[model samples]
Target: MQTMRPNPSRSDHKAIALMYLAFFVLGLVGSMTGPLVPALRHIFALDFRQAMAAQWLVLVVIGALAWPAARLMQSWGVFRLLCLALGLMAAGCLAVSFAAGSGYFASVLLALAVIATGTTLLQVAGNPLTTALGAPEKSHARLALAQGFNSLGVLGGVHLGSSLMLGQDAAQGVQLTYGILAVLTLAGLAMFLCGGKAFPTSALANETAAPSEALTSRWAWAGAAAIALYVGAEGAIGSIMINFLHQPHVLNLPMAEAGRASAKIYWGGALAGRFAGSWLLTRYRAPRLLGLMAALACALCLTVAVTQGPMAGYAALAIGLCNAIMFPTIFSLTLARSKAPASAVSGLLCTAIAGGALISILVGEMADHTGLAQAFLVPLVAYGLIALFAALKPAIWPQG
Candidate 1:
């Protein structure tokens, strides 16, 4: 790997700022569904599973494009690729703004698919590059910092959608909200282009290397499964929090209030946890923390599944605290475990994020058949799997 710049220049700082901005935007746009679930259902006249299908499309694209993105990143480099992803996001937002006016569900879905395509590429480039920008030993901390901004974006976006996109007129709300997103995306693209010369793409060197070791490692696969389950479980939980809180027997807030509530508990907890996790990972073994957090998340989900009222609400919210460090921790641990290059391991791990689609769909369907609270069993199971992976990580990678 190319060594990082010990003393970054002015342009390098600009590049880092733009990259982190892109990460924030990714979280903002990606988490839109959770808060807008009520709007999607009301506007489209759909059920739980149908509204949840929005994520299915996004994750499908992410999974499909992430693995091949290593070659693309190699050819284009991070700066150019990020600019392209921002452009794609802007275009998707533009499409959404227009499509939403007509209340056409298909158009919005298509726009999100395009957005996810860009996001997948961005993640493939951004996640590892954060570590590359500094010392290698601090990768876990750096990734946590990137994901901290992502969590902030999620918190902001959810509240934004709740206020602007969920109301008596869903189409109007979407139009206004997405119009703002498009403009912001374009602005981000412009800023990145001006400083584009400073960004490096050394990780893209994965293209020149063999993937045999990464492909063969059991720890790699185990880590992939752990990531998949973690994402899936998080998605499942996010997808339901609005509706779960909307239940009259539970929090019983209106859709907007429910969304605000979820943002505070779900995304807010993540935002705080990630910033703290950045420091915590420096003090603790990544796998041990991962196992403990996953176990705690499992307990929280189980509590949500079986309980009601404020207890359930508190439990569900607490899960985000446990979830805060899992992704970056898992990514860093898996990267260490892999014998392949950073870029190759990043692609595989990014693709495994498709678990969100599969698991969220299952949770949604279960909600349709059973109840929203009980449907949380799906994430409960997922968290359990991740906990198992964390606990057995030493067995899986005894040499470490």
Candidate 2:
């Protein structure tokens, strides 16, 4: 069998579009779980800790699974891995729906873990594949565009979850939504399996490539750390926003209204920021652009932490705009200069995705003890580190 290699064929536009569509669907499936967070809390009568644990369960599983999945892509190729991921997501979605209907909290949590496992694999494979397909200088813009489609998926996920689950009996509405997501998962699986031959094969021929021999060194771990912290900071802020806004002496917005408004503003900011980033990368250096965005994010996190009412929520939402470019920018910067081992290093960087799990838990604990207002400080620390990394532009090459 012929080994797959990255193609610079601009004629493969259809393949590019299909990859973006797959990413869009992946984004939709991932964020669909967000709006369901409140419903899960109500149905299980879970305190903040338990509810947050359920979400983190998925993130931890995804992080744990990413390295193995990267290895699998080396053997099976991206299309097959995508198929496996979609199938897992489908099965997990169906299991969660049934568990919700049966009021089985443990079962629901397990199902979410399953779904996350698949999505993590898809992420590990898909992102690197996209960057590899495009030109060196254009990689950031391509990733930004692909991720913009992801933003649209998030917007739709929130809208779908809100329309279906909000104000309805929590159990039934939530169950139906999961069921719908399951259908979408299956559809995605079928499409990807049929399109199997289009995507490039993994960058590593096998997982055993000597660390020092590889062109793209694990030194990119610096960039990966930034990504993990970035994800954690983003998740922490969004996860706590509703609870923060509802506190008696905090923002004090009504629960139902605040939840919906918060979702809109947060995703709205994400959407706007990604579009702007796509345009900016065409002109500016990614490292400089990332530093500016991190600074803006720090300022916004502080604004949300200290202010109250609509102002606080809006400030929090604006952080999404600052966040929009950081991930793709960091990813492009890290991988752009890399050579043969880009895929393996991509998988390594992808593990930082677990940040969503860890950061949120830390913030949740802080909220439990110090109050949501103070917990916001957790991400502030992360953003500061991210800023320093942005300034350094550390090399991904191996040193003796």
Candidate 3:
């Protein structure tokens, strides 16, 4: 394997700033699914599970494309790959904007799949690159800080999607919102092109480990499982928030109003917690903090399951706070403890995000069959398992 040394003249801070910007755009575009669910269902006349297929398809594309994206990053270089991903995302957004007026459900799904493909490439490159830009020991904290920006994007995306897509003229709203996103994505791509010379290119070099090698490390598998559950639980809850809030027994708000409420309380809580978690991770062990948050999230899901009115609604929203640190912490912890090639491990970890596709379907089914409140049990179990993973002592492995 060849190791590339960093150029002393290159600025790590510039690279980090670019990465944070990329994440922010990712959050903005990626978060539209939850808020769009009601509009999709109404337009397509879909049942709960069918409506959730939009989220499921995006996640499935992520899982399916992750490994290939990792391999592409190795050969193409992170900078070039990021540029390509951003361009692809722009194209996808434009496609979605155009398709919104077509009245064909499949066209929308196809456009989302294109967007998900771009998002997969971004995630496969972005997470590890962010960690590599800083001190190795501070990987968790650095990632958490970056994710805070992502949550900020989610906050804006949620509100924009709710206000635009949930209104009386849903099709026009979808067209305008995604048209704006395409422009923003193109702007991000321009920034990367203009600032390319300042990036620490050497920091993102990958080891030439075969994909199969990552499977040998127990930490890789453990981390993959945790990532899957974390994403699944988060996606399921977010996708259902508007509908759940509209339940007569819960908040009983109108659909459009409920979308706005979910955006502020649910994703907004995540925006707050990630900043706090970033600071806390600097002082506490990543595993301990992860376990604690997972337990708290599990308890909150239980509360939502058994309660009603504002209590249940608020309890559901509060899980976003617990979710704030999980993806970054679990990712960095696994990277720290695994001896596998970083690229291979990252590919496996990203692939595990397919769990969102599976888990969200289960949540949708439960909502259709039993009740939306009872559907909380699925993620409740997922969180319990994640807490168990966090509590286990880290296995000794040589650091890369």
Which candidate number would show the highest TM-score if scored against the true structure?
Answer: 3
Q: What is the TM-score of each candidate against the true structure?
A: 0.94, 0.90, 0.96
Candidate 3 minimal-lDDT segment of 10 residues:
1-10
lDDT of 3 by residue, 1-400 (tens): 1232343234777888999999999999999988778888878788898989888889889998889998898888888889999999999999999988999999999999999999999998888888887676677888999999999999899899999998898888889999999999999999999998866667756566655677888888999999999998998899999999998999999888888888898999998999999999999988899999999999999999999999999999999999999999999888877888777888889999987788899999999999999999999999999998888785343333
User: Best to worst by lDDT, what's the order?
Assistant: 3, 1, 2
lDDT of each: 0.80, 0.73, 0.88
Clashing residue pairs in candidate 2 are: none
Q: State the TM-score for model 3.
A: 0.96
* Candidate number with the higher lDDT (2 or 3): 3
- The TM-score obtained by model 1 is 0.94
For the record, the alpha-carbon RMSD of candidate 2 to the native fold, in angstroms, is: 3.3
Better of 2 and 3 by TM-score: 3
Model 1 Cα lDDT, one tens digit per residue, 115-178: 8888988888887777667666777888898899999989988888888877888878988888
- Runs of candidate 2 with Cα error greater than 4 angstroms are 1-7, 200-218, 247-256, 337-340, 394-400
* Candidate 3 residue-wise lDDT at 258: 87
Sliding window of 10 residues with minimal summed lDDT for model 1: 203-212
